[model samples]
Target: MKPELLPLLTCPSCRDGDLTLEAQEEDALGVKTGRLACPTCRTVFPIADYVPSFLPEESGGERWREAWSYKWENVAEQVRYSPEGDEDFERKLNFGNHFSGDFRGKWVLDAGCGSGQDAARMASRGATVVGVDQSRGVYLAQRYNQDTPHADRLHFVRADLFHLPFRPEIFDAIYSNGVLHHTPDTRRAFDAIAPLLKRGGLIGVWVYDRTQYWRLFETFWRPVLSRLPRPALSAFLHAVNRPWHWIYRYRTLMMDKVNPWPESSVARHLADLFSGGQLLYLLTDYHLHLAHRVEDPFIRHHHAFDAYSPTFAWGHDESELFEWFKAQKISVTAISPVRTGLIGVKD
Candidate 1:
C-alpha cells in the first residue's frame, strides 16, 4: 500500500482515524504481505498479493461473500454481447454506457466489482481501472487483467465498501453496479465513498429497485424463502419454481401469438428469460448447490448465504433514489434501459 494513502484512511468499523501496520510476511518468493489493523476496532482485514482487504467482518453472513465468490472476470465475461440474439452483452453494454459518462482518461473505481468484468470494459475504453471487492474474487480479477494487453492500466484490490483504502480525491470517477444494496447499511456505505471523490468528479451507482411490487415480493417471499435451510429449501423451491417458468412462457407465447411484432421480440424474450432465470437463480444458486463451482472456485457455497442473509437483499426505487441524490447535489443522468439500473453525476 502507498504510505500516503494510509494517512487518509479511517477505520470503517469504529470510524476512528487511528490505524497501524503491524506485520509483513513473505513466502518463499519473499513477497511482503500483511494486513493493517484498526487500533480501535481490533479488526484484522487481510492484505494479500498487494491488495488491501477493507470489507467489514462477515457478521452479516454469506450474502456478500457468496455473491462475490464469482470471479470478477467470470461475471464480466458472462456478458455476451450479441446484436442478433434476444439477449446479448451489447444490449446491456448499450444500457450500461449511460454509467460510463466522460470516463476517458480517468482513474475509475469499480466498487462492489464481483468479477473485474466492468473494470476490464472500462480499461478497454481507455480508463485506468481499480477493481475492488470484499471477497476472494480479486484473484480472478488480477489474473483476468494480467492476460489483457492493457494490464498496466488495470489493478485489482480487496477492499470494503465502507472501509476503502484509497485517499480522498484519488479517483477521477467511481461507479458501483448491483452493489451497495447487499451491504448492511446502504446509506452509510454510500456516505463512506462520497468524500473520496474529487470535487466535481463523476459518481454513479446502480442498486436494486424498490418499487411497490418489488416491496411486496420482498415482504412476502424474500424473507420467507431466505429462512429455510439450503438443502431442504432449495429442493422445495426447485419443485415450486416450475410454475413461474410456465407462467413466463405462457405469457410470452400468448403475447407473441396475439400481437407479434419484431420490436416486441427483445422485450418479450427478456421478460421470459428473466422470469425463469430469477427463479432458477434463487432456487439453485441461493437455495441449493446447483450453481456450485460451475463458474469459480470460491463460489461453490455462494447462494447458500443468500438463503438467510437479509442484508444482501435490500433495494429502492428510482424516484426515492432521485430525491436522495438530488439532496446530495448529484445529478441524475440516466436510469438505464432497466428500471433497476441508475446513473448519476456529481456536480
Candidate 2:
C-alpha cells in the first residue's frame, strides 16, 4: 500500500484515527510490506503485495473466498485468450451507461471490485480509484493495475462491504456493479456504503433483477447448487452446458412446434432429435445463461460460475432499490435502459 492512502484509512474495529504504519520493508516506490496498527484498539492489519487486508479473522466463508479468488486469478487469462471481442470495451461501456458523472480528477470508490478491471478503467480516465473487496481477488486487482501508468491513481484494499475501513463521506463517487446482491443482505449492504459518499456525490449499482426466470432459479436451483462441493458443482455445471449449447443451436425446431407435446406419441423423441430437448433447459440454461447466445466457451463458464458459486445471490426489482435509495436521502438520478442499473445522487 502507498503511504498517501494512510489518511483515508481508519480502524474498522474502532473507527478511530489513522493507522500508524510499521514498515517491515520499504522501497523508493513506497511501503512494500507493513502492518497498520490502529491507535485505539492497537489491532494490526497486514499489508502484503501492496494490498491491505482489512478483513476480520473469519470474515468471508472459505468457499466464498475460494470461489471468487479462483475466478479472478484465472479470469485475466480467460479474457485474454477467449474469442469474446474486447471485454475491456464492454466494461467501459457498462460503467459509462450506469455512472453519469464526469470521472476526470474524481476520487471514486469501486466497492466490491472483483478483479480491478473497472477500477483500472476509472483510473485510466483520470479518476483516483480505491478498489475494495473481501476476497483475495484484491491481490488480482492490485497485480492487474500495478504496472499500468495509472498505478499511482489506483489502490486496492481487502475489506468487507458492510465494514469499510475508510472515513465516512470521503469519496466523490462510488460504483458497485453486480456486487451487493451477492451479500447476505443487499439492503443493509447499500445502507452501509451510502454513508461513504460525500453529499451530492453519485452512487451507482447494478444488481440481478427479480425477473420471473430468476425467481424460479433462486427458489429451486440456486439453493441446491450453492451448497454442493465446489469441484463437483463446477463439473456438473460444465457438463450441463454441453446439451444447453446443443439445444440453443437447434432452438428453431422447438419454436416451430415440430411434433407438439401430448398430441403426438413421438413428441419426446422428436424434441430430442430436432431441438435437443431445448424446452427442458430453456429458462435455466439457455435464456438465463446469456452466454449461450455467444460463441465463447470460456465466457460461458465465467458467467456460469459467477452466477452459481455465490452463497448469497438475491434479486430485487426497481421499486425496492428505488425505495432504499430514497430512504437514504439520495435522489434518483438515472436507471439504465435495462432497469437493472440504478444511479443516485446523495442529498
Candidate 3:
C-alpha cells in the first residue's frame, strides 16, 4: 500500500476514524507488509502482498467470495484482454462520450476488481486506481500488478462493498462491472459506492440483463451448485463442461429466433443437431476452471460458476438502474449497446 493513500482510508469498524499505518516492511513498490491502526476504534487492518485487506468475516454461508477467490487462485494465466475485449470495455463504459480516456490526474475506483486486470489497464491510461474486492482476489490482483508498467498507480483493498473504508466523495470516477448483481441487494450495493464519487465524476456499471433467458434456471440451479462440496462441485463442472461450451457457442442463436446471423446454412445445421436440447442452453457460463478443456492447461472453466455460485445474482432493466442514479442525484449519460449497462455522471 502507498503511504500516500493512508489519509483516504477510514476505519470500516467505526466508519469514521482515520487509520494510521505501521509499516513492517517496505520495498521499491511501497509498504509491502504493515498494519493499519484505527485509533478511535482501536481496530487494525493488515497490509500484505501490496494490499491493505479489510475483508469482513464470512458468515451466513456467503460463499460467493470463495467462488471468486477460487477463480483467481485457479486461473494460472494472468487474465488477458484480447483487442476485441478492449473495444468491448470501451463500449461497456461509453468511453468517448463519458470519459476523456486519458486519465492523467484522475483518481478512479474499481469496485469488485477481479485479478486487477482492468485496474492495470486504467493505470496504463495514467489514472491512479484503487481496486477493491471483498474476496482475497484483491491480494491476487495486487501481486499480479506489482510488476506492471504503472504498478505504482494501482492500489488494492479487500473489504465488503457495504463497508468500504473510505471517506465520501473522494474518487474522480468509479466503476463496477458484472459485480453489483452479485451482492445481496444490488441497489443497496450501488448505494454503498455512490457516496464515494465526487460530484461530476463518472460512474458506470453492468448488471445482468433481465432479458436473459437463463435467469430463472440459474436461480433454481445456483443453490444446488453453490452448496455442493468442493469435490462434488468439481465433478459437476466437469460433467457439464462440453454441454456448457455447446451452449455458449450457441447462446447468440438461442437468444433470438429471428436474428439472421444464426440463419446461415451451417448454423441451421448445427442448430438442428441440438434442437432437442434447449435445456442445455440455459445451463451454461462456467466462469473459470481453466487448462483442462480437451487438455489445454489454461482452458478456463465456464462463467456458469459466476452465474450460479453467487448467493445473489439479481437482474435489472435499464429504467430500474436509471432510477438508482436518479435517487443518487446522478444524471444518466449513456447506455451500452446491449442495454445491460449504462454510465452516469454525478450532478
Candidate 4:
C-alpha cells in the first residue's frame, strides 16, 4: 500500500496499535507483497497481490463471506463502469448535489466496498480510496481494477467492518451502500464506521428500503436456498425462467439464452430506465421487477442470489436512517426521494 496510508492503518484487534509495514515486494504502484505487523496485539496482516487482507482464513471461508465473495466475482465484469457511462453510481451517491462529482484531494472510505466498484469510481474522480470488505471480494476487486487509470489511488483490504483498522477521523468522507443491512445489527455497523469520517465530512449511505413487497417471501426462502451448495444454488438461480414476462412480444427466455442483452436490448433498457429504485422486487418471484432492469438473465441470476443468500437482510425506513445520522451527530442534508439514500455531514 502507499506509504501515506501506512500511518492511518491501526490494528483491528487492538484498535490502538499503529501498524508497521514490511514490504517484501514493491513497485511504482506501491507495496505488492508485505506484512503489516501490530506491535501491541501482534496481529500480522498480510499483503498479497497489491491488496492487504486483514481477514483470517477461517473468517474468509465463513458461510456469508463465501456467498458475497461469489456474488462479486460473478458480476465483476458486468458491473465495470463503461467509459460510455453508468448512471447507477451517480444515482446511488446522489453525486452532484451532495458533494459534487469531483473528489480531488480527498480521502474516502468505502465501508463494505463489495467488488470495489464504487471505490474505483471515487478514485477515478480523484479521491484516494480505501475499500474494505470481510470477504474474498477484496482480491477480486483488486484484480478487476488493477489496470484502471486510477489504480494507484485505490486500496482494497479485507477486514471486518465491526473491527475496522483505521484511526479516528481519518477519512474525508465515508460511504456504505447496500452493505450495512447485511450485518448483524445495521445500527451497530453504522456506529462502527461513523467515527472514521473527519468532522464536517460527508457520509452517503443507501440501505434496503423496507417497502419491497417481496421482503417476507425472500426471508422465508433464504434459509432453504442458502443450504444448497453455492454452485448448485447459483445454477438454480440461472435456471429460473418465465416466458410470459414482458408485455412486448419477440423477447422471450429462449431469445435471451441464445444471445444476451442485444436481442432484447431496446425495450428492456427503456423499461428499466423508467422502472425506479425498487426495480429488483416488484413481482412475487422477481420475474418482472428484475427482468428488464439488469443487463441480461445472467446478472438477474446474480441479483437473485445476492438478495436470497445473504444471512442478514434488514430493511429500514427513512426515519431509522435519519436516526443513524442523528445519533452520530451528523446533519442530514440531501436525502434520495426514491429510497433510503441518506447524505449527511458530521457536525
C-alpha RMSD between model 1 and the true structure: 7.2
Q: Stretches of candidate 2 above 4 Å error?
A: 74-77, 80-101, 253-289
Q: Relative to the true structure, how large is the alpha-carbon lDDT of every model?
A: 0.58, 0.74, 0.74, 0.74
Cα lDDT for residue 185, candidate 4: 86
> Which parts of model 1 have CA positions greater than 4 angstroms off?
1-32, 35-45, 56-105, 212-219, 228-311
**What are the models' TM-scores?**
0.65, 0.84, 0.84, 0.83
lDDT of 2 by residue, 48-121 (tens): 98888888887646577776776677643465333343353244225455443457777899888877777887
RMSD of each: 7.2, 5.0, 4.8, 6.6
Q: Report the backbone clash tally of model 1.
A: 10
lDDT of 4 at 84: 20
Clashing residue pairs found in predicted model 2: none
Model 2 clash count equals: 0
Better lDDT candidate (1, 4): 4
Tens-digit lDDT track of model 1 for 240-294 = 4445445544654665676544633666545644545434444334422233223
**Model 2: what TM-score?**
0.84
